[model samples]
Target: MTTSNGSSGLFISFEGIDGSGKSTQARMLAQALEQDGRDVVLTREPGGSPGAEEIRALVLQGDPDRWSAETELLLFTAARRDHLERTIRPALAAGKVVICDRFADSTRMYQGLSRGDLRAKVDALHELMIGQEPDVTLLFDMDPAAGLARAKSRATVEERFEDFGVGLQEKMRAGFLALSQEFAARFEVINAARGIEDIAADVLARIKARLP
Candidate 1:
């Protein structure tokens, strides 16, 4: 179930609040695995594939209130479906490590808990449309205030979520921690408020231990 249609490749997903350094760690993990002679396919949700990438612009670059919570959920699910079809599944089928920056967990947090109580809806959509879960999900936990500061400093068009402010980040951080407990088997909570190299080393080791 974790490897997509029973494929042999490892599926690893990085999850955290905005600016928590999960993206950097995901990339570094991919590079480290490749350096170790492993076939690695590093991708991300919302914009992993061509179709999803299009949806990404529509959802991520607009005003925070541009789309209703339910509408945003549908859009994200559509993008994830495309991503799975065009990027994740094929790579896993080819026996390559699929490292994703974010996955359904983010949706489960952002849309499921952010605006309102939509976790049930998010879960229903996921079970019906996208059934696969990552073999391991590294949760980069950090202070919400610090993370929000780092996120706003990025100055990227994807600031829609960041624009929600620190209050949302605080709520999101708690939501993500709860998720880690809910999906404890695949979730590894990492303190992300540290040096990049140190965090990368820890992530690499944790992932290697879970690799088949």
Candidate 2:
């Protein structure tokens, strides 16, 4: 793993498809670290800050056909910019371990795989908006169909990603795997087919080994 500069605590991100158990694992990891006496903060993308939450509702509920790829990318970046400035940066600066449910990686995979030609533009925007990347990223790998099934079983209402067809979900999964290969040190792909406690334990072990 690459060494991070200064005294700022580690920034970790949990990423995956809708039903890959990212939220559950992120919380478990944070709790375990806190129990171990490490300061930790848990937050989620597109809804961490109040401003970002409002923007999240707009982006998620709006008609996808009505919004262009460029527009979608911009909206997501706007929320991320707010989240970074208001929530993530402050917590990390105080030497608190920040465990994010999702980050810029989700946007890269979803927008890049689903919208091809717009990928470069999104990448450029990401570079401009999010200056600091997470120290470690845990990607929960699972079959798209199984993920959708699990998500549906737990969800009270369907979101845009949940409404998407199987083909797009498969493409998104492939995109995440390709990204993990590209950034091997920063990205750790965990098999999420196991029970929640077992997956959380594996994630905790990785985080503990990586902590400075």
Q: Per model, state how many residue pairs clash.
A: 0, 0
lDDT of 1 by residue, 64-153 (tens): 999998999999999999999999989888888999999999999999998779999999999999999998999999999999999899
Worst 10 residues of 2 by lDDT: 1-10
- Candidate 1 CA-lDDT value: 0.92
Off by over 4 Å in 2: 1-6
Candidate 1 regions with alpha-carbon error over 4 angstroms: 1-5
TM-score of each candidate structure, all chains considered together:
0.97, 0.94
Supply the global lDDT for candidate 2: 0.84
Cα lDDT for residue 46, candidate 1: 82
